[model samples]
Target: MNGGTDLLGVVSSLLGPGGGSAVDPVEAAARVAWSALVEPGDAVGGLLVQGLGAERSFALVRAAVDDGPELLVESCRDAGLPGAESPSVLTGAVAEALARWGPRLGRVDVLAALDAARAVGARLLVPGAAGWPRAVDDLGPHAPIVLWTRTGRRADGPAVAVVGSRANTVAGAEATAEITSVAADRGCTVVSGGAYGIDATAHRVAVAAGTPTLAVLAGGIDQLYPAGNFELLRNVARQGALLAESPPGTRPTRWRFLARNRLIAALGAATVVVEAGARSGALNTAHHAAQLGRSVFAVPGAFSSSASVGCHRLVAEGRAQIVVHPEDPVDTVLGRSRHATPGRGRSSSSGTPVLAGREDPEVLRVLDALGRRALGEQELAARSGMSFAEVADALALAELQGLVVHGVGGWTRA
Candidate 1:
């Protein structure tokens, strides 16, 4: 097995102390190599690297692989890493890992990656490095092996994530841009997974507002995904920052996209899901944010829209608070003040206007029919001039947002 000697030499030459960096060359090279060695968000790889130093762990894995799959499984069991304590259970896992990682081991070139990053003025960032975002530490064992960063500047305050569906609506995109701009202007950095729709809108607005926005990518920084956003990502790299855990030459895969969500969630002080379906990847980021003890916010969408289902679910279940306006995150991070810009209106849907820049035309009509009295679904549908089916869907969403409630009598405005 290749011990990555040539890879180390290349990294050493590229990461010399010319920039006044005191980081060890060997360690940097090992991190770059390790990033290529395992997939992003590999908890076992993180555990191994943290338990043993990256270089030592790299050597151990290499030696074990060279010793063959059986020996590798034995070594893993002896090391007592999670999922490996049971020798029988670990054997298959080790063999599978060997199959996945072995063929690519000889192909990684840390030098090429470093050179590619340098060509674009990006730097390879490891833990403990200056400008590293400490918030990512919240990921614990699932933390990234290395980060490729464009901007050398780190946020002076907490970063907030703005995420949502790629097929977002105009209102959702507008909300993301507006919210991100407000937060950035209020001294927060905007972090996102750098997909289209909401992610693109957030980054553009933040940059235009002169707020530092971080684009957390699934693929290599050198290989920006969604080819359509190439220029936009380049602008982000130049003006704000572009970050990726994957090394150069790595393509964005479905698994990588899912794994990258954790980084976006962990890097933020809070996560705001602008719009998401029940199965949206933005929800995944929200889940990670909640797990890390970060506040999760969801922007309410029109009740009839599928895009808003996840956000409504989050709000109704108390998993997240409703963000009616852009300044909610700013208030959470910088502390609420009388002088702070007003949010959509109230924190909860109770006693708050239903169509406050949220409800669609149909939803507005249905809400207007509710008035101040209780009405059955059929009666409300007739009064609102909407179909019964439409009324039912709208009421479900309104109830979830706490805008309306059902009781012994029927439905009433909350």
Candidate 2:
């Protein structure tokens, strides 16, 4: 076979036979090539892949090696890929990007990366893959070319990220574990960077609770960082997923970590900051979550605590809602039970009642049956002694009234 056919075969073999809903192997290989060709969050790479298909874009980049990157820019403009940005601005941006990307061109070996991923039992998930999260689409031009994932199964529920300072206080650690336990027990997948303090606490608690947990890494799937959290990350991989945009053996850099924050924020339905100092990386994730229109919650620490300035600022600026207890209504919005906390009413901020405390008896029955755990429509119907249609009707009304929420895991009380 020729080199082109040989490359395609190697790519296709990684996905294996009967890999349902996996992307075309050739296109997937091109994406892996792009991931290595440019740094994370490379806008130029994003535009090329977005405007032209990945295969065509890869061909253009390869052609540019001899023809000059300027030709690629002109081709993009000719293809009507340049939107709104003035030609002069686009010209300079493309020029600067070319300087950065050109040197890396020779280093891209799609087949080697694909082989590395296969060796590690990882799969390349492109945009249309069966279990790709729809939330990251919010990044637009900044979305990852592909995600390298090692997962046991696709989580049935949406995740909630718990992020905070690496130098977190004891209170912050306790808070992370508490909130994670509640969220996981209610069938929410827990997501976090595999870092120390709060991120580690969140992953550990979620794994212990038998809930799916995803650790979005700054490096490659093969090179887990922070070495101290190796065991925890391994458990996370077994129970949930280890996701990265980088190929195998890539080292974590400062810029890569910053770029990695976007994925964590985009993956979660909501992000909760347990404790963060001023200018913390957790704040970066919170900003990304806010930009994606996802809920941001801050756990308030003592006013005297230096580790909480970011959280306080977020709350005061109205960028985040204050979450003092596990049962706060924010969890409900993500389809976790708002009544999950053992002593919810003990705190005065039980939040306003849904429908002014005069809910329909059928809706109330479903909510009671839901408790803190997720229940599918049929299970809810069985437990509530209501028909499937009645349960559906009740769930819809309750969700509309803010009394309950329904997500991939089914339904839960609000």
Candidate 3:
């Protein structure tokens, strides 16, 4: 801690104007090292950092470089850190960690990471920082050691995590938009994984609603992954906040994506999955939320849908409650009364526009599938990912109100 003066100097210079928690310069500098040295979900690293202060933890790693686990384990045991009670077990773990960390030791350049953050006007946040979201502390040993944030604004309200598949359907998109709209109306911050499909839709709606939206990234704050969402994420960084566990130049690996989901789940008071396929990553987020004892909501999708499979499974297993009403989940989580149910009528004064049949999931799915130029039942069924029987029922209802017209080519918009 005392010898990191050069690191402290660089950190002082690179610290930007973003809203941040007040942390000790030495502690913050050591965290920068940990963030740069380890992978996103390094449980060993997290445990060590939490057991020993960042300064001591970093020093332990440095000391163990030659002195070995003898020094590291003794230090942790002396600190009364759990797991150190068994010296043999802790020694083996520490030795493995030290070996993995040795190669990266020489490369830990605190200045480079800070410079990259400074270049993007990002700020560093460590646990106990003033701006740190306390909800994430629920992660316990899995908590992030450091969070690199751009815009650095701290949202002052409850947050809801909206997550879904990257390959989303119209119904899924509609459901996400509706949920996001209601969340924003409740003055809740919307948290998302800054990916495509449902994640993108939720962010767009939250942004349009002028609500504080947080986008957690798997990569560095300097490089927003999923190139398609760069602008949208930039908008979020400009207006609300963008956070990452990695330092400034880290590329998002698959492991990191899964790791960042925990951050998303922890940040929100509740996590809602609008749509997810059998293998959707959003389910991982829901799992993380559930583990943290956060409320989880799943919007029902067509039984024929491949997208909602994960959500359906979650509901069936009672891991998550079904979202009968978008606002119902939000209401329950925030412990407030629901707004008057969204009828198939005009937009409310709250400025939440209601789409016809927005209350009817299948009807919304069918309507969204109809598009500018539509086809017959067969195509509609395929396009909407609905069974022909479901499409027929929806089309029949829509045609009764001139919502569609059957032509020689097929069914087109009326």
Best by lDDT: 3
Q: What are the models' TM-scores? A: 0.74, 0.77, 0.78
lDDT tens readout by residue for model 1, 1-414: 233676655554444344216566677778788898888876556766776668877776777678876655565567676667566545655555555577878877767778787776667777776656777876876789888877745556667889998889999988987888788778788888778889989988888887788899988888877888888887787667888889876789765777788899888877899988865778767766766667788997998998988888777767788986788877776642333432222233322322232445765677799866556666788899999888876665554344554432346766
How does residue 205 of candidate 3 score in lDDT? Answer: 95
Residue 271, model 3, lDDT = 85
Candidates in descending TM-score order: 3, 2, 1
The candidate, 1 or 3, that scores higher on TM-score is 3
Give the candidate order by descending lDDT. 3, 2, 1
lDDT score, candidate 1:
0.73
Model 3 pairs in collision: 21-130
Query: Candidate 1, which segments miss by more than 4 Å at Cα?
Result: 1-21, 69-93, 335-414
Compared with the true structure, all predictions reach lDDT values of 0.73, 0.75, 0.76
- Clashing pairs in model 2, backbone N/Cα/C closer than 3 A: none
Kindly list the per-residue Cα lDDT of model 2 for residues 335-371, writing each as its tens digit: 4334332211111113332133234787778777786
User: Comparing 2 and 3 by TM-score, which wins?
Assistant: 3
Question: How does model 3 fare in lDDT?
Answer: 0.76
